[model samples]
Target: MEVCFVVGRNGAGKSQYLIDQAKGNNQDSLYLCNTVHDRSQELKTSKRFSVKNTGSHPNNVMKSVIKKMMREGTHRLHQIEKILLYCGYASHITVTMRAGKIDSRLDDFSDTSSIKKLTEMIDNYFNGEDEISFNVNFGETSDISSLSKLENLLHQEKPLRHYGMVKAIEISLYKNNGEPVPLLNASSGELSLMTSLIFVLGEISGTNMILIDEPENSLHPRWQREYTSMLCSLIEYHEVKVIIATHSPLIVTGAQLDERVSSSIYHPATGNLEFSSSTNIEELLWGQFEIISPKSRFLSEKLAEKLEELSAHKVSLNQSIEFIDSASKASFDDGQQDIFIAARQLADSIARG
Candidate 1:
């Protein structure tokens, strides 16, 4: 299981490349998306193709192609390799694309007794009228439109019992009377946390490679740290291959806070993959108070502009103030103010030269 992150700017062709790889070589590929009607998740919606030599016939809907895939066969060895594609999809569907291959038939995937039990389970769930409810422990919302109340809620010390679009979830756990909790009660960050926690726990238990993209999207900086810590713990305990893609500075900062995470982010630049940061990048990113430091390439251009301005023969107090303000805003470290002060004091030297 080789887990890797492929990151680039939007429209960088990264997702298309990954899709092609999944299409070319995979028994099953699961694509989970949060948005409905997203074009990215558009793949084979039906399982048939048609052509006409010449005729007035409009063509058929190809329901048989779809039905064949839906119909399960009997042998484990003869079982069709499934490609599970999902987008804004809660239900799972498996598909197989074979080119007139007749050997792809099944007759013994399970024993008669096992098949009977499976059939019973499916029929009972799908055809039966009776239902069973599970107990859910979500609390009620007190403030729906009060800003002050919402602000105060944000200050809560403990994690919400069940948060973020939770009420909207298909929770088996419900009240005795069967009313579920409402989704509005949870904040975006709370929902993000809940989803991450559930996903890490529920899925990826037996996955070959687990991939998370821009996981810091809806999370607060603090929760980013918390989630990173939780992920580290899970990866260690499970010994699974994990890869995360993020453009958040907070994610990098969070990983730097922990001693266990070692992988770095790689981004595609000009069709060549560039290493944005290894484990060593952050340690060297914020170091050195001096602008002349070798690692301070990003700040070098700004520093040069400041220095060139100071070397002129006509400088003033107002100019000094503006320079200091700009430098402070573009600060690399604590010594930023000191550099501005140095320029201010040397105004006479600059004016003389």
Candidate 2:
């Protein structure tokens, strides 16, 4: 499997790159864009699934899973079950007061009929009923023993035990306090992660390429670090190539930490994507992505010059103090000002020594 990590700032043509690659690739491909809504129409591929359409509707996603299972066979049922457990599916109908009148909307996507069918299938298979069979021509035969083992593992992980409850006509995920949290009510990060994983794993097979834009969006720093490794593992399982475009340093560094995956940065100024050997986040920010703002860059250069002068003994202590004071006088925003202040203190200490 070929795994490529593309890191760059906004408007670095990351999305365009993925689009072009998907268009050019002769083999089957799946393009998942978190930023764009309903891009599947523009991309003109049934294999491509975006968060906008599919992520909002859990019933629709479950329906897709059932269809895939029918076509691909029951061997993948464990993966399907895992995704279903993680994805938030229950939604509550809500009402609002407007001008002394009531306005109500139904946010729930639960299809009782479909849920019943899915639950029946699961129950029959797990109960070791010989009447049910989900084998198809897609590939391997159904592995009930392996599926049983995975089901046990998933149960042990506590995600299923903690978050999910499966029923004959309904399945709902609850929060730690035992209140049900629907997908729509779930955090943006959680929704994105679950939806992306579902679509990717559901349609990964028989495809040579996968293009994902900004998978790190709305994810926590820890999740961002694990994002690349997770995708690489999935890609390897499917035996497909994947191109990921992201702005997160954690995502880039995470890929670097994984020896199995390859990482690169797209330099917008140079119009080239180059392999990055430097693991330093500072080097990545400045050299590869050019993420430093002009004002911050100016301040950084000024601080470096002042520190150099102090080290070389080319300026008096008083002069160095004056320089530092003048530099700090410049108005800077929160992070930039903090950096300038730290630089001033460091330079002051060096000059005094």
| lDDT (CA) per prediction | 0.37, 0.57
Candidate 2's TM-score: 0.58
Over 1-353, each residue of candidate 1 has an lDDT whose tens digit, in order, gives 22344455566654454444445533333232222222334434211111111110111111122222223211211111111000011112111111111121223543556444433442443244332222211122222233222222222201111211011112221223434333223355544444343334433334444445456666776666555665666455565544454454555555645666654444444444333443234422332111122233444445445556666524454665575566456454675567656655665455566
Determine the C-alpha RMSD for candidate 2 after optimal superposition of all C-alphas.
Answer: 12.0
CA lDDT of 30 in candidate 1? 28
Error of 1 at 35 (Å): 6.7
Q: By TM-score, who's the top model here?
A: 2
Task: Enumerate residue pairs that collide in model 1.
Answer: 74-108, 74-109, 75-107, 75-108, 75-109, 76-109
User: Where's the lowest-lDDT run of ten residues in candidate 1?
Assistant: 78-87
Superposed model 1: Cα runs more than 4 Å off = 1-8, 13-184, 271-353
Off by over 4 Å in 2: 37-40, 54-56, 80-171, 174-185, 287-346, 349-353
What TM-scores do the predictions have?
0.44, 0.58
